[model samples]
Target chain A: MVIVVATMPIWLPATNFLTLTDGVLAGIYTLLGLSLVLLIGYTGQLALTVNVTYGLGAYTTAILTVDDKLNPWLTILIGVAINVAFALVLALPLLRLQGHFLAVATLGVALIGFTVFQAAPITGGPNGIDGVTPLSIGSLQISSDTAFAYLAWIVALLALIGCRNLISGRLGRAMQAIKGSEAAASSVGIRPFRVKMMVFVLAAVLSSVAGSLYATYTGFVSPDAFSVSFTITILVMVVVGGLRSVWGVPFGVFAILALNAALQTYGPSLIPAGGTDIPIVGYGVVLIVFLMFLPGGLASAAQRLWRSATGSGGPRRSMPEIGGAVSEESS
Target chain B: MTFLFAGLTVGAINALTGLGLLIVYNVTGVINFAQGDFVMLGAMAAILFAGANGHRAGLPLIVAVVLAVMCVSALGGILERTVLHPRRKSGPVLLLIMTVGISLVLEGVVLVITSSQSYGLRNFTPGPALSVFGGTVSLQSLWVFGVTGAALVALYLFFSRTRVGKAFRACEINPLAASLVGIRPSRYWTYAFALAAGLSALAGAVIAPVTTATYDMGLALTLSGFVAWVLGGLVSPVGVVVGGVGLGVAQGMVNGYLPLGLVAYANAFPFVILIAVLVVRPNGIIRSLAERRV
Candidate 1:
């Protein structure tokens, strides 16, 4: 609400590309954050592969749109297809590992993704792929910042609705059951493996959408943007925003962005060294503080404030378990 | 012949890393992902301490290494007892994220204090080449192998002969049962943390001379150790040692035999190995062997 009120004029101003870019980036985060919440928050899987999935999406779109000269609509579909296939291949065995082992394994995936994108010449290596043309609909073009922002938010909103529908349906209940106890869920006829794999593919596809939008917005894709640290940052957002709630995703992303902007704009002069690198330090501090104290995430905190102001509790969602609660015998 | 010795030298370092990882994993049921960062801290501390005292030549290198390990071990004990143990019931995902957060803070703090430039540890070995069998090797490489071997033997003895070590293993296998037997679970965690940190310190002290120390070196080391642990099997010291040696030899051979373009892909070895093992042997080599025992 404050964002709309504060940036009302910038949306239409000719020199407002920077503000438009920020809004589009926030929109992309919404998609990434929502996808992460679906797997991590809803299904209780601690996946560290969001950024890798995002990179895959971007790379897929880049190759199809630029190298192959595919249609914009076709490129998006191809991107989703690639991510889904990757997820299926990864999910079959990757889902068996639990706890820190799973986290480390996923971290390895992210690192490998970075290495492949950085080392492989076909993917443009370190310099990254450039000249990615924006999506066009006849006369309408998505090259400008304002158009990109609106398009990104539209896709993000649709994804949010799709997630809401899934969570509010039978599949949602199955996922929740799986989250609470895989053995019990299986006993009750819910195939825990199928549910996990479904969620993995779903999350990967959503992340791919965001990645494609991000590629269109930037007109470039680099390995640097999809490093392991990017994965950590996205996890921090989900954690800070409250993992279970649907609305918490955007709240987390904007909070992180606001923090980033604040540090970038104001932190340099405050430091004796007088440099722009303190934002990295700030992001690190924010993550530590949030994890140490606000374990339920920023979403829960936001709900608390809303309830206090309105003199009633807002709709509350049960805090999802962070990982699998049921231990399975590897028989 | 030197390639063989290089394999052993790198293998010894990997073994030390795995030893640290096994200690923490056994006690806490949580892998300390920040283990490599601790190793980085150890090496950085030694370099700084050396810088402050290296001019005098009065402080012996052995004493400096001991002090560095002591300080880092203390830090480890404090972190485990206070920050980590307080939220033990939160499960492993949060613990993993928290450790990652801690790693970020440590890396940043290291950068803030010392800058991001890599440093070299002063080598004390005799410069002359030593001959063995039909081959010649650097004296320093032989020392790395010897020290790592002694450390492993000591660890073996400690676990087999000491009351605390037995209690620690008991705690690992069944925490509630061990607590009933009057072993405080928290104390075991402290011992694990201290021991893990000490192992990291020794790894840093030994390898920094060869690899050069940097703030970010810990992540790479951690990845190598992680690959070795997963390959050999987590929580098995002998498996870790053997895995470390095997991995080092594999890496050495790749470096020696692979073409120029593939050599640039050498750093990808650990990750490729990790993905393959996770996909093919999620239970790890030792666990699979043990599973077949039944």
Candidate 2:
């Protein structure tokens, strides 16, 4: 892996571009991943509806800019509104379902979203809503790579702050309480259902906002972009980053993307004629290895190293793992 | 009338898929996401065999179906012992992810081995059409309906009449208690997996003539089965069949009666029903009736 990173520029022209472009992509995905961490990791809810919310954001921005002739700034707000409303409708009932059933239910939402985008003529069917006008100020278009990178960073930073505040505040405590035990939480007047629904909805709205900006930034929207694969990728990011550690998300995103990039660049040399397909094997192996060894994720690994370096002698508290269970059944 | 016959034919296939899903769900208590992949592999294997062994005029369709089922069941057993057994102690979510990972590996391997082109499993042509209930029906449709009905009846008898079947039921109801009573739950898991894979393979072999084999078809079918499972309340065989057929007919009806805008919603019907039922009744439509049994 180190050798691949060292020799990257020799093979991938995107190597220099990757340091910049990949960084931006990491930031964007981190935003989404952190939202998922808050939802699934801290709140003890399993939601596979991220892609649907994302598509809704993209569609909203596309429609507003292309059909309604609304400004890009206004489109962003509309995107958030649409996403929140959709999440509200879904969360009202979906929050009640737990475990595999909840996962299936959210998966249904995503599948239905995919079907709507692919089959409905108004949404351009499989062709998708394309030709979205790029977000711009009156005199200067926010079309350059540097500009868009900054835009993504700003949004990601705000989202990070929002998530951090939510996690540390009274609401965050209530959410953690709910995660620990819903019955106990409600007994203490936390209103676990409503709080969970609120967090889920907020997560959806944030993801949608990111999606809208992404569509406008990329100037394209396709059903292919918002697949179950994308949802899984986001979930993997949170799991690989150490859920509940807000600072770990970017590392998680970067780790996976870097691994993917490395496989794409140097995998062919390692296995003759394997080509780009080796990453398929790489991701699976990485997931299994991480799940077995580093269940707390890369952040946890870094924390261990830092603690050792500082010679802090206190016994470390075992991080409360919310959903992971080695037993056949998990609540 | 022809479309109704077509719908019925597809409905029978859905029944087979539902049956395959139920067997695994009953014994192992894991909703195998790779079920559709097994179906796809079965069809592909049969297609390859037919190409290599010659699609002879005298070869029986039953023989081809049996071969497909046997091969796929063996594959299921291999997968269960190798990947699933190690992760037997994991939570359902982790197991779910493992199955998905297994699915990803299977898809990549299949794509590399098989060409991207679709293949025809042409041996199962029940030649000629006949009149049935004021509609033109093919022998193929009749064969599918008959086979699925027979399979279900056989399954019902086996579950009720055989000691192994009784053991399987005991495992499903309560694995801990079943183990106390000397039933090997792990062995049951392998057996149930084999049963599900075999049935899925048979369904694939039957439907391959109508729909060609594609690498990614399994994922969608698996998702639909999940929707059916949710709609049917997960544990009831009768409810599963009803839900599966109802979903098929619902999609068919939307295709038949709706306008273009609404017809596009046909594919989304299962998901829409799923979300609705989840919101309205999380336990599914039969939850109230089956509360005591469950």
Name the best candidate (by lDDT): 1
Which CAPRI quality tier does the interface of model 2 achieve?
acceptable
Best by TM-score: 1
On residues B1-294, what C-alpha lDDT tens digit does candidate 2 reach at each position? 766777766666666676667778777656677888887888877776565223444335567677878999998988888777766666566666666666666665666455455766663554778887787877767776777778778878788899988888888888899999899888988998888888888877777776778877777777666666666777777666667776777766666777865776777776788788777766668655554221
Kindly report which residue pairs in candidate 1 clash with one another. Answer: A240-A298, A241-A298, A241-A299, A242-A299
Off by over 4 Å in 1: A1-19, A308-331, B52-59, B126-136, B287-294
- All-Cα superposition RMSD per candidate: 3.9, 4.2
Model 2 native-contact share: 0.44
For candidate 1, lDDT tens digit of each residue in B1-294? 767777777878877887788788878767787899888988877766665322434346677778888888888888787777877776666666777777777777776565676877776474887888876777778778877888888887787789887887788888899999999987888889888988888888777777778777777778778887877777577778878877887777777777887665677777888878887887687664433110
Tens digits of per-residue lDDT for model 2 on A1-331?
3343334334334654356556557667877887788887677677888888888888888877887888878888888998888888878778888766787778888888887777766666678777788888788898876677667777887787788888888988898888777988899999988899889888988888888888888777888888877887787777678665676776778778888888778877886556667666666556655555565677778778887899885656543332132231354
Residue B162 in candidate 2 has what lDDT? 91
The TM-score each candidate achieves on chain A is 0.89, 0.89
Q: Whole-model lDDT, candidate 2?
A: 0.74
